[model samples]
Target: AQSVAQPEDQVNVAEGNPLTVKCTYSVSGNPYLFWYVQYPNRGLQFLLKYITGDNLVKGSYGFEAEFNKSQTSFHLKKPSALVSDSALYFCAVRDNVGSARQLTFGSGTQLTVLP
Candidate 1:
């Protein structure tokens, strides 16, 4: 079984400052991690993924995450924050060795960028 944990229910950041959303995962085999963002009444939008390559992976909208195998963590980071960046973020994980297309997602973290 695979699972993801986003400890924070909400993160508040000021516009122009850097922000980070924490995520951790657990899986039987090598994990395929992904990050997605969702807006009000919208489906999840793929942000980035860590399949097999550089530990530091960059994604849409200046977002990046580091895959730490030892810690079993993939934390999302943005150098600068924006008011429009505020949305619901999720961390998902799946077993790389399995063929299942389903992804186990975190509860979700609401990001609020104060203007």
Candidate 2:
């Protein structure tokens, strides 16, 4: 079975500073990793994905993540943080070998960007 681990329950960052939300995953076969963000009352929105590409993958809102194969980690990073970036972030993973497209999501990390 595959699973995602988000070590932090919340991440606090100052506006204009860099921000990161950690994520590590485990799976039996090759992993397809993804990141998503959720607003106060909105559904989870896809941020980016790592299907098969360069180690560094860029996504929406200036967010980017590095796919570390050895570490099995995909940590989201942003050069600068903004107040509007405060939201819940999730890391999801699924085994590419399986026919099922089910994704196992992390516990979710609430990012708080202070002005």
Candidate 3:
């Protein structure tokens, strides 16, 4: 079985400050990790992924994530946050050596960028 966890239910950051949304995962095999963001009344938008290669992956809206295999963690980061960045963030994982193609997602973390 594969699972993801976002320990923090809410993350508050002031505008123009750096922000982070933490995520950890457990899986049977090598994990394919992903990050997605959802705005109010909108579907989840793909943020970044960690499949292989570099430990750091960059994505849309000036976001990036670092994959630490030793720690089984993939934490999302942004150098500077915007009020518009406020959204529900999800961390997901898929087992690389499984028949299950579906991704198991975290409970979700609501990020609020205060102005």
Candidate 4:
């Protein structure tokens, strides 16, 4: 089984300040992690992924995530946040060796960047 957790239900940040959205996972064998963002009335947009190789993965809209094997975490980060960056963020995980082809997603974290 694969599961993901976004501990924070909501995250608030001031414009131009650094922002982070935390994610942690548990899975059998190796894990494939991903981040997605959803705006108002919009579908999920692919932000980034950690399939293999690098521990640090970069994604769209200046977002990046660090894959920490020891912590089983993939925390999303941005050096500076924008008001437009406010949206719902989701963390997902999939078992690399499993027949289950679906990715398990977290409940989602609402990010509000105040100007």
> lDDT tens string, model 3, 21-61?
99999999999999999999999999999999999999998
The candidates, ranked best first by TM-score, are: 3, 4, 2, 1
Candidate 2, residue 114: how far the Cα is off, in Å: 0.5
Q: After superposition, which runs of candidate 1 have C-alpha atoms over 4 Å from their true positions?
A: none
User: What is the C-alpha lDDT profile of model 4 across 1-115, one tens digit per residue?
Assistant: 7889999999999999999999999999899999999999999999999999989999999999999999999999999999999999999999987599999999999999999
Writing each residue's lDDT as its tens digit, candidate 1 over 47-82 gives 999999899999999999999999999999999999
Cα error, residue 24 of model 4, in Å, equals 0.3
**lDDT by candidate, in order shown:** 0.96, 0.97, 0.96, 0.96
Winner by TM-score between candidate 2 and candidate 1: 2
Ten-residue stretch with the least lDDT total in model 4 = 94-103
The candidate with the higher TM-score, 1 or 3, is: 3
Task: Give the deviation of candidate 4 from the true structure as CA RMSD.
Answer: 0.6
Tell me each candidate's TM-score: 0.96, 0.98, 0.98, 0.98
Residue 57 of model 3: what lDDT?
97
Which residue pairs in candidate 4 have backbone atoms (N, alpha carbon, C) closer than 3 angstroms, thus clashing?
A: none
Count of clashes, each model: 0, 0, 0, 0
Cα lDDT tens digits for candidate 2, 87-106: 99999999987687999999
Off by over 4 Å in 2: none
